[model samples]
Target: MAHHIWRRSLAVAAGTAALTVGAATAASAHHCYKVDWNPNAYANHMSGNTAWMPLSSMGAMIISAPAPDGAGLPQCASYASVAVDHWMAETGATSEPLIHSRATVGSGAAYQGKTVKPFAYLQDSDYAILEEGLGMAIDQCMADQGA
Candidate 1:
């Protein structure tokens, strides 16, 4: 399951017994210039924010890097947030069952459409690592199918 793989990856990155993975540490000091980035395979992956949806739909989820905390302000490079509000609505988890979850982003607000969001903050130096991680997972999944 994607959950198991993601959790294991998080655990490996965090170096913690708790499996609470977020983002890698930034190596630089000054804020790096903004970059237009996203995972190429989002259309085929899933996020806990979208647990409401079947694994089949996980890859269809598209999301942006974490924006700064304030409006129009993007969060630091190490912070990318995801939104599951759309996925939740699509899955009929409209009540407290999904609202109380931190895995889900937005309140069915902000972004418009269907998707699962898992907000992750990445180090400024490695803003795109998440995509690579996803790619690796996808490759592994594909390899599994081939086997």
Candidate 2:
């Protein structure tokens, strides 16, 4: 009976150790910043030279290259624009109408001929509008892509 109890205690200790290690690993893997406006709850991985995120089933936002300053807001905005453009192209067929409407009326109005600054954009109400429009477009894009 003593031998069985010792074996059970050893097993419990090993299990506790494994659980601690697993929790640490998961915590470390969450190296992204969450976006409040994004309906998909996308998180921006701002580590290294490039900053990007995934948009649910729609697709991923991949920066072509890392910004010079690494974590500058302006650079992040620039990269975001590029990534959005790429997403637009990939989903053009299904998203053209929505994108065009936005360009003519809604969130796109704020973006016309304007350089995007991440901080300023976030502060603007137009940011939420743009996010909504973008979410719609992404949904259509995903449907078109058979995803």
Candidate 3:
């Protein structure tokens, strides 16, 4: 009985290890594919008129679009988070993920004395910040283009 129990335990451990390795392999195999978007849909500058903006991440290049009126920063963050959640949903890039999202935005740190609001949601109770640099880059792009 003891030997039988040991064999069963070993089998279970082996099974768990195999499942973990398979999941990791699948995830690593995931790659970004081609996508299409209207170039005009993205904002060229920051304005009272909200618009979609792009953010870069490790998994993909994402976008942050304006939140509905009264949705505030949380909504903007959601826009970014969702884009990263699915990656290709908001990007036009055809290559593997590139760019490290980074920037200093409104009431945040200093980036050439420009601080724009972050467009992507980087932090939440359920997950750590995705690519903060992407958030910053989005804000800076808005500011630079607006200027």
Candidate 4:
């Protein structure tokens, strides 16, 4: 079974509680696809913006949450997570149905004097797609950072 992050640091909770996820260890990713790319997004720059990311794990990926106010974000809060999950399922990541029936303003992390909220509900069923999304976002960040 793939191990995903059952719990992670929610830096964007504004001192709120961090999030808790449930998944297998086989698919546990140390570096979240979306978070890895946008380190300073939630706290410093885009607090309420969402970012799509590609991942190192094949077609897997991630999506960032909406940036907060006064973060000078690039993207706005949208249902990007749903789209990304669909993309992952299309590519054969997992069969778990994408459940966007509820609107979730999930938690974030505090990195680099900034708070970043994570958007995508990355799970085993959708790991591939989110990871791929993380990869995409990371690629974008690399270009932006000239890395």
Candidate 5:
């Protein structure tokens, strides 16, 4: 009777340990695929804008942004050019991603009755760099307009 009770207790303990390990594994797996967004970054940018969300843990969206205006496609292209230049200057050639700009005419919240030339950074390290680069580009544009 004593031997049987001991065996039963051992079996229960083993089952509890297995369950605990499984639960821990599942939690870690879930954490890896979670999508996090930075509200501060979202608030600072304009209407037609996308970038790596600030303060994210792992994984980032393919960097992309819609052009500013529909009628002025060249203006949008120029803006992307300037932004890329600023980004390159800040991050250098080795760290900077391949910048691509393309114009697309569409009607939506971000692009309503305008041609938006989207800018994409192929390989960027973090949101901070992208945000700074974007801010610099926009500032340059503003300065040009002011001049």
Candidate 6:
């Protein structure tokens, strides 16, 4: 079940990264960015005060869910922040991460219109590494940003 995978991934992430997995209602620092589901594989850009992360629609919903307290923001913003940081560092990008300027021009666009796949249906163990990696990445990003 998706809940099982989510719990497992969270556990693995916490253990490996040694970071507390807090509620979706994160701090102000995590609110620095917003996510936009798009056709891009992975892309990020800063627009004014908000960092925008563009990913597949499914990916966006997974990370944008509200906290248990029903707050507007989610802790998964950390994941997006860390991912953007790594992409920037890996590509030596001072401003952008991907060459494509359009957010909805890839094959992923076909499925972008579908209703967000619920977390209960997102039960794929194969992607556990992604969750774990994002967890560690967030920790690293936090340290790098002095947050």
Error of 5 at 88 (Å): 2.2
Candidate 5 TM-score, true structure as reference = 0.28
Q: Please name the candidate that would achieve the greatest lDDT relative to the true structure.
A: 6
Give one digit per residue, the lDDT tens place, for model 1 in 62-108: 11122221111111111121122322334343321211122434425
Per-candidate TM-score against the hidden true structure: 0.21, 0.21, 0.21, 0.24, 0.28, 0.30
Collision count for each candidate, in order: 20, 0, 7, 52, 3, 0
| Candidate 5 root-mean-square deviation in Å | 23.4
Candidate 5 per-residue lDDT, tens place, 17-123, comes to 32233223322322111122245544443223543222111111111211121112223224444434554566554222321122221224223534333422222
* Candidate 2 collision pairs: none
Candidates' C-alpha lDDT: 0.27, 0.29, 0.30, 0.31, 0.32, 0.35
Q: Write model 2 residue lDDT over 77-143, tens digit each, in one string.
A: 2223323444345544222111110111223434576543321122223223333334343333333
Which candidate gets the maximum TM-score versus the true structure?
Answer: 6
Clashing pairs in 3: 45-146, 77-121, 101-133, 101-134, 102-133, 102-134, 103-136
* Pick by lDDT: 3 or 4, better one: 4
lDDT of 6 by residue, 5-94 (tens): 565455334433322222122221221222232534233232322233332222223344443222112444445545444544554435
By TM-score, is 2 or 5 better?
A: 5
CA shift at 8, candidate 5, in angstroms? 74
lDDT of 1 at 134: 35
List model 3 lDDT by residue over 4-111, tens digit each: 555444433332233233223322222211123333423221121332223322212122221221112222233343324433333333422221223222323323
| Candidate 6 wrong stretches, greater than 4 Å | 1-61, 66-73, 98-103, 106-133, 138-147
Worst 10 residues of 3 by lDDT: 62-71
How would you encode candidate 4's per-residue C-alpha lDDT over 78-145 as one tens digit per residue?
Answer: 32344355555576544222222212223334334444443344445454444344334434433344
